[model samples]
Structure formats: structure tokens, C-alpha cells
Target: MLDIKLIRENSEIVRDSLRKRGDDEKIQMLEELVGKDQQWRQSLDKANALKAERNKIAKQIAEVKKVGGDASEQIKRSAEIPKEIARLDDETIALKTRVDEILMRLPNILHESVPVGADDSANVEVKKWGKPKEFNFELKSHGELAESLGLADFDRATKVAGAGFNYLKGDLALLDLALMNYAINCMVNKGYTLIEPPFMMRRSAYEGVTDLADFENVMYKIEDEDLYLIATSEHPMAAMFMDEIIDEDKLPLKYVGFSTCFRREIGAHGVDTKGLFRMHQFNKVEQFIFCQPEDSWKYHEELQANTEAMFQALGLPYHVVNVCTGDIGNLAAKKYDIEVWFPRQGKYGEVTSCSNCTDYQARRLNIRTGKHGGDKKSVPHTLNNTAIATSRAMVAILENYQNADGTVTVPEVLRQYMGGKEKLGKV
Candidate 1:
């Protein structure tokens, strides 16, 4: 939630920020909350005054009783005061709940530089890499290519555990592992600490880490349990320090989390259902950071560069798209997605997303700090970048490196990781 103090003091400024996100309804709600707050405060003031009068009259009654006079009138007056104060207190509590509820539902205001638009179609392209390779013969989708190379088993995977699951055997499994290690190494070299966060996260903890809507759309809630299968290492890895204050000297703590993430794949009925591109489970090396608000944007660029470097090394053609304000989603203030070109699909597919969420996520999680604990307190900014998503990367690797004779040539950089093999052709 955004700072209520800021909202109350500079509501128009906040409105303008939200306008960039095209959230007019939320802005209206803020105005109504302010009115409720004023009414609640006035009632509280009246209730407090009545209580003060009651206390003063009680003291006089004690003096009168000591002098052997009637104290019945004073007692009756005090009784009314207690009832009045209690009623006002109840109203105040209810009003506070309403205020907090609105605050929680309001999405983060967009950063000034975020392009204003409705959807991905309006997302601006930041940069483009190598062109999609031209093929002399027919190009096969990742599913066909992997099957031919004895890499993936989709039918068996579905038999074992419903749809949108996969079994990456042989070189494909090795490739997934290699991608995870490769991404982690790159992030660590760029000053990120590597972590293997727990695979399962409780609903309470997960809620602090992501938006409420994600519970239905993206997460897998454990039946009859309070836990939810984590959709990304980002969830537990980022929530580790929830409701905690960090030392100023420890500013900009960065972590690269590697884990197999699980999602429900809800509403993805007939979308990307063929291969590993969209799956119930996939490996990911995620980059998460806690930084001073001022440093988050700079770190955002650095994170993008790390992902870009990895894509370039993999010998894949790709482009960077600056996620527009509305399309940037609720968490991130500004975002960039690295979309890799798939020769078979003949379209760019997202392989990485780098976002600077500013202080939005931190404030919700109550992750805050001050300079030396005595300085100005503020919510630390949080940022997450997809260092590598193995599912999507496989699409690029299989399609880009496919040989004319049904072989997949491993990128030169990954050869060392593959025991110095020049190519992943038929053994």
C-alpha cells in the first residue's frame, strides 16, 4: 500500500501519478476515503471532549460525596459519556478498515518515464538484436525439434500429471540446468548473491510478495493447506525480509534465486500448450534486489544488460520491449521484456522481464529502513529481473540452432558446459 500520509497530504499529485496508469476509479476511491477520514476524526474529537467532561464531573462528584451530598446526577452523566465514546470508537475502527482496504487495492503509480498505453501492442521496442535466421527447408516447432532429437516427452508428461507439464530428457534437461547455472553465474558476477529459496510458500507470506489476483491466476494453492506452490523463486526470495528493516550500510542487497517454479496455468487452456514455452513447472534463475529508491532505476538497467548479455551469448536473435504503463502490470512502475525470436514460430517470444518496482512492493511488505536508524525512514525499492526462464529459452535454442539434417547445434559458449561438444547433433 502507498503511504497514507502522502495520499492525504498531496492527493492531487498522487492522482496524477495514477493517471499515468489510467486508474481513474482508484483515484475516485481515494477522494472518498479522505472524506470518510475527516468525518471519523471530527467524531473522535467530539467523543474525546465528552470523555474529558465526564472525568471532570466525576472528580466533582467525589468531592460532593465526601461532603455528604448526592452524587447520583454525576454518575448518570458519566454513564452516557462511556456509551458515546464506545460508539465513536467503533465507528473509527470501521472507518480505518475502509481506508486500509482501499489503500491495499490501489495499484502502484507509474514512474514518470513509463510510456502510457493500454496493452502489449502499445509497448515500445527498446532495441533489436540479430535477425531471425532464414531457413532453406521447413522449420519445425520446438516440440517437433525436441522430439526428433530425443529431448522432450510431452505425451508421457501429460499422462503423469495432466496438461501443460513436460519431461525434458537427455540434452534438453542438461540444457535447462546449464541455463540456470549460466544465469546465476552472470548475476553473481554482477554483484548478486545466489540463493535457493524454499519451493513452497504460505498464503500469508505469498500475499505479501505478490498481488492478490495472482492467487487465482498464477498460483497453485495446496489443497486443505495454508501453503501455495510458489510460481517463482521471486516470491519466497523477495519475501524473506518482509516486515523487516535493514541496516543502511546493507543497502541494495541483491540475490539471484534459482528454483523450479509451479503455477496453475489457469485460463491458459489453448495457449502455448504445445511445448515447454508455457508449463505448469519450469526452472528459472531470477534476480531480486532491495535498494535505495534512488538506485532502483539504475539497477534496473544493469539487470537488463545482464539478461541481454546472456541472450547474445546463446546466439539467439531477440529484442527488448519497454512495457507500457498499463501493460507494465500492477507491481512494476517501469518494465522491459526481452523477447527472443523463434524461427519456427516466426514471432518474438518473451524470455526475460526486468522491472523496477520502486517502493511499491516494499511498502506493501513493510520492508523499510532509515539511514543509520535515526535518519529519514522510507520504504526500500524492490526490483526483479528474469535472468533466465528455461522454458522460453528452450524455444529459442531449439529453433535457432536446428541443423538442416535434424540436429541442434549447441551455441559455442555453452559447449564448455556440455563437455566441449561442438554440437548437439545425433550421437
Candidate 2:
């Protein structure tokens, strides 16, 4: 949600942002909100004037009665004023409700640093890490290699749970657990408090962390219940401090949330139907931060650097891209995606995304910070990044570490976590 005061004072800025975002419909809605607000203000003023008149009349009637004069006419007039005031009050409340409905539909204001673009193709690559290796032999895709080694069982998974699901068997299952433990430990070393939050959240709380449209497409709401399964740990972590005020000293709060995330994948077809690229459920270690407004940009960079370090430690080649305007979404003012290289596909696929939401979510969640009665309250900024999505990490590992003899070499950093196992899928 955007600040209505900002829209009232700087409507041109909001209009131009919507234009740049390719959302003319919201621009029209802004006009409606302004009109309704004006009417509400006028009605409120009328109601206040009537209230003042009623008070004065009551005083006049009391004085007349004290002097032994008839006060019946004054009493009748005063009663009529209250009925009029009540009617106008109802009108004002309706107008305010309409205005609020439109406000929720408005997107966040774009930051000045964001690039103007329509889609991901317009996104600019800011940096590149390690190079993609040259293979002397034909490289097998992650799915092919995992199935041949009896490490992944998609057929049984489909029979058990339908499409877009898989079962990791043998050493691959162990590798998945190793990746989760490794990522959590890495985050712990970086001073983030580790939390395993609830896998489900109430609809009211969920709305605070995501766009309203997501309720229909992305989320899995339980039938006849107010609860919805979380799509990421970020959702629950971000809502942890909803409708609360924190002390200024606790400005920069950080957490590494681990959970089993679920997505509906409603329309996904003919894409990664055989592998783990797009799954209905997966494990993730996510990074979330809440900090003062002045320090959010600094924390955004630090968050990006932290994810890059994790990838480098795992020996995965990746690059960073500055997300374009349309593709960045409304939650984040600016975003950076770390696309890790997949040797079999000959392309870099997105493995992690870091976003600086800059108070956009804070406003919706009503999260603020200030001293008690000494300083003015202000909304804090929010940021989140994927420390590691275990499935995608496994995808990169299976293809990049594949040997000519079909054995998979474990990344040196994760070997200790996997009980000193150096390789997987060996007979």
C-alpha cells in the first residue's frame, strides 16, 4: 500500500510511475480516489459545523430555561441537527471505504535508480562470476543423470502425488539434507538468527506480505479454513512484526528462515515436468531483514554479497543481473537475481533473488520504529533474498559436478555436512 499523503501532495510522481509501469488502469483509479477523498473532507467539515451549532443551541436553551422562558423550539432544532449530522457521517464513512479499496490496488512507487523496461529481456547484467566449463564428453541433464543413478524417482512421485513432484533417493536425499544444513550454518556464521517458522499463515497476515492477486494463483489456501500454505519462508518472516513498533536500537533485524515452501504452479505446462526445476514443494533457507530507512540500501548490498559468497563456496558459476522495471514486481523498488550456470542446458538459470522492498511492505504490515513519545514514528524498510533453494542447488550440482563415469562429486564445502562423503551414485 502507498501513502495517501504522498499521492495527494505528489500526484504527478505517482501518475508517471504508473505510466512507466505500464498500468494505465491504476492511474484512472488514482483519479477516483482523489475525487472521493475531496468529497469525504467536505462532508466531514459539514458534520463538524452542525455539531458546533448543536452545542451552542443547547447552551442557549439552558439559559432560556433559567430565565423562566419557553425552550421547546430550541430543543426541537437541536434534535434535528443530530439526525442531519448522523446522515452525513454515514456518507463520509462510505466514501472513505471506497477510497481505501482503490488504494490497496495501487502499486508501490518506483525508485529513481530503477531501469525503465518492459520485461526480463531488458534486465541488465551487472556482474559475472566463474566461467561455464567446457566438457569433453556429452553432458547429461540433471534429471537424466539423477534417474540413471537411482537418486531421483519421478515415476513413483507422480503416482503418489501427481505431477510437479519428485522423490530424492539414496545419496541424493542425503545431499539435499546436507545442502540445507550447510546453508543454515553459513547464515548463522553471518549473524542471522535461525528460525523454522510455521508452514502456514492466516489470510489476513498473508495479504500483508504479498499482492492481492496472488491469493488466487500462487497460494494454496486450505478449503473451509482461513489458513494458507506459505510459498516461501520470507512470507512468514516478514509478517513476524506486523502491526508492531520496535525500538530504534533494534533497527536492523535479520533472520534466516528455513521451511518447506509450496506453490500451485497453476498453468505451468511442458516445462520442467520431468525434473525439479519447478516443483510443487521444496525446502529453502531464506534471508529477511528489517532495518531503518536510511540503512536499507546498504543492507541490500550486504544481502546480495552474502548470497554470492554461498554460491562461490559451493563452486557454482553464477552472474548477477539488475532486474528490469516490469519484471521486478511491485514489492521491491530494486532487485538483483543471481543466475547460476547449468552446464547441461548451456545457460544460467536463476538460483537466488535479492530485493530491497524499501518500506513498501512495511506500510502494508504497519511495521514501524521510534522512541516512546520522544521521536516521530516511521516505517522501516524490508529486504529478502534466497540463501539457497535446495532443489535448484541440486540441479546445478548434478550437472556441473558430473563425471565421465556417471558419478557425482560433492562440493568440498558440503562434504563435511554429508558425513565426509566425497562422491555420490557410485556402485
Candidate 3:
């Protein structure tokens, strides 16, 4: 959520941001909120004046009584003041609620560095890493290769859980774990505290981290409960300090989170529905940080570098793109996506995303930083990056590391974690 003060004072800046995002409806909503806020301020002023008048009348009544004179008139006026104050108070509360509702839905202000564009096609490529390798033989899809090597059971997974699910068998399962361990260690060695956050979260907390109204279709709600299965560990990790104030001395809180994420994938059309590229449930390692606002953009790049390093270690060819305005979504002011080359697809697919949500989430969650006793305080900035989504990483590996003889060579970095195994072949 944007700071109410920012909306009230620098509205044109906010309006321009909305225009850049191509959201006219939100612009109308912003005008509505401004009107409502004005009304709320007027109502609050009336209530406070009535309260002052009542207090003055009480003093007059006491003075009259002390002098042994009539005080009924003042008492009557004071009694009437309470009723007026109460009405105005109720009006102000209602207006404030309406204002907040719209404010919560408003998208974050884009950073000046973010590219102004309508969609992903306009995203600018920052740089490329290793080049795609040449294959001498016709390549099979990752799904076909996995099944052919007896490494996965997609047929059985479909029979039990429908499409968008899979069962990794034998060496494939171990490779998944190895990926997790490798990513986790990569982050841990970089001074990030390891965390295993809850897989389910309350709707109220979830709202602080995402636009729940727009994101509901992508989330799985727990039946008859206030909880929803988390779409990413970043959600819970970012919400960890909701409604709390941290000391300025502890400015940057970096965390490496691990979780099994679940998503409804509603309306995700024309994507890989039968393979590891997209899934209803998957294991992931996430990087999250909470820091002072001034240092957020720096941490944002740091996160991207960390993720790219992991991919580099695994010998995966990839490139980074600066996400355009429209595709950047509501939370991030700016974002970067790391796309890895897939030999079978003859193109790159996104394997990781990094975002810098500068005070947008902190304002919603009421996360602040202040001195122990000083009055100065401000909202902290929040950021998150995909260290690795094991499923997608596996897809990249399966396609890039497939041998001509229907086997997959394990990445050198993950060999130790896979019990020194060099290849994933038929069991």
C-alpha cells in the first residue's frame, strides 16, 4: 500500500504511475479515495470541535456549581454535544474504511528505472551468460526424457491428482533434493539466515504481502478456514514482521526460505500443463530481505547476483531481463527475471524472478524501523527472489544435460548431494 501522505501530497506522481501501468480504473479509484479522505478529515474536525466544546461546557458547569449557581444549561449543552460528536465519529470511521479499502488495492509506485511498457514483450534484456549448446541428435522433451529414463511417473500422477502434478522417482527424486540442498547452501554461505516458514497463512496476513483480491484465483483456500496454502515462501517470510517495529540497528534482515508451494494456477492457459515447467505443487528455495528504504535497490541487485551465481555453478545458460511496467505486477517497483535455456524448446524459460518492493509491502503490513526510544521512524523496504524452483530447475537440467543414450548427466555441483552419482539412468 502507498503511504496516505504520498497520495494526498504528491497525487500527480501516483497518477502518473497508474498511467504507466495502463490502469485507468485505478486512477478513478484514486480520485474516489481522495474525495473520501477529504470527507473523513472534515468529519474528524467536526468531532474534535464538539469534543472541545463539551470539555469547555463541563468546566463552565463546574464553575457555576462551585459558585452555588444554576448549571443545568451548561449540563444540557454538554449532553447534546456527545450525540453530535458520536455521529461525526461514526461518519469519519466509515469514510476512513472506504479510503483504506481503495488504498490497499492501489498498485505500488514504479521506480524511475523501471521500463515503461505494456507487457513482457517490451522487457529489456540486461545481459546473457553462456551460449546454448549444439545438439547432434534430435532432442526429446524433458517430460519424455524423464519417463523414458524411469525417473518420473507423470501418468500415475495424472490418474491420482489430475494434470499439473508429477511423481519424481529414483534418481530424479534425489536430484530434486540435491537442487534444494545446493541452493540452500549457496544462500547460507552468503550470510542469509535459513528459514522454513509455514506453508499456510491467514487471509489477513496474506493481504499484506499481495493483492489478494486479484490473486485469489491463483491461491488455494483451506475449506472452512481462514488459511490459504502459500503460493511461495516469500509470502510468509515477508509477513513475518507484520505490525511490528524493528530497531534501525537491525536494518537489513536477510533470509533464505524453503517451502513446498501450492498454487491453483487458475486461468494459466497455453502453458506446459503436463510437465515440470508448471505445476500445482513444487519445492522451492526463496531469498527474502527487509532493509532500510535507502538500501533496498542495492539488496535487489545482490539477490539477482546470488541467484545467477547458483545457475552459473550448475552450468546453465541463462540471461536476465528488466521486467516491463505492466508485467511487473502490483508488489514490485522493479523486477528482473532470469531465463534459462532449454535445449528441447530451443529457447529460454524463466527460472527465477527478483523484485524490490520498496516500502509497498511494509506500509501494508505496518512494518517500521525506528530507534529504541526516538520518535523518527519509517516503513522498511522488502524484497524477494527465487533462488530456485526445483521443478523448473529440474526441467532445465533434464533438457540441457540429456545424453544421446537416453540418460541425464547430473550437474557437477549437485553430484555430491546425489551420492556421487554422475548420471540419471534407468533404475
TM-score of each: 0.90, 0.93, 0.95
Best candidate according to TM-score: 3
In terms of lDDT, the best-performing candidate is: 3
Which ranges in model 3 have alpha carbons more than 4 Å from their true place? 58-72, 266-273
Q: Which portions of model 1 miss their true places by more than 4 Å?
A: 44-80, 266-273, 371-375, 425-427
**Candidates 1 and 3: which is better by TM-score?**
3
The per-residue C-alpha lDDT of model 3 at residue 292 equals 90
lDDT of 2 by residue, 1-427 (tens): 8888988888899889888888878989999998998898999898888889999999999999999999999998887787788898999899999998888878888878777889988878999999887889988888888899999998899999998788899899999899899989999999999999999999889989998888888899899999999999999999999998878887799999999889987345442325878888999999999999999999999999999999999999999998888888878888999999988777888899999988889888988889856568999999999999999999899999999988889999999988899998642
State the C-alpha lDDT per candidate.
0.83, 0.89, 0.91
Report clash pairs, candidate 1.
none
lDDT of 3 by residue, 1-427 (tens): 9999998899999999999999999999999999999999999998888888888889999899999999988887777777778788899999999999999999999988889888888888998999898999988888888888888898899899988788899999999999999999999999999999999999889999998664556798889999999999999999999998899999799999999999887335243324787888999999999999999989999999999999999999999999999899999999999999988877887889999999999999989999978899999999999999999999999989988888889999999998999999686
Name the 10 consecutive residues with the lowest summed lDDT in model 2: 265-274
Number of residue pairs clashing in candidate 3, backbone atoms closer than 3 angstroms, sequence gap of 3 or more or interchain: 0
Instruction: Evaluate model 2: give its TM-score.
Output: 0.93
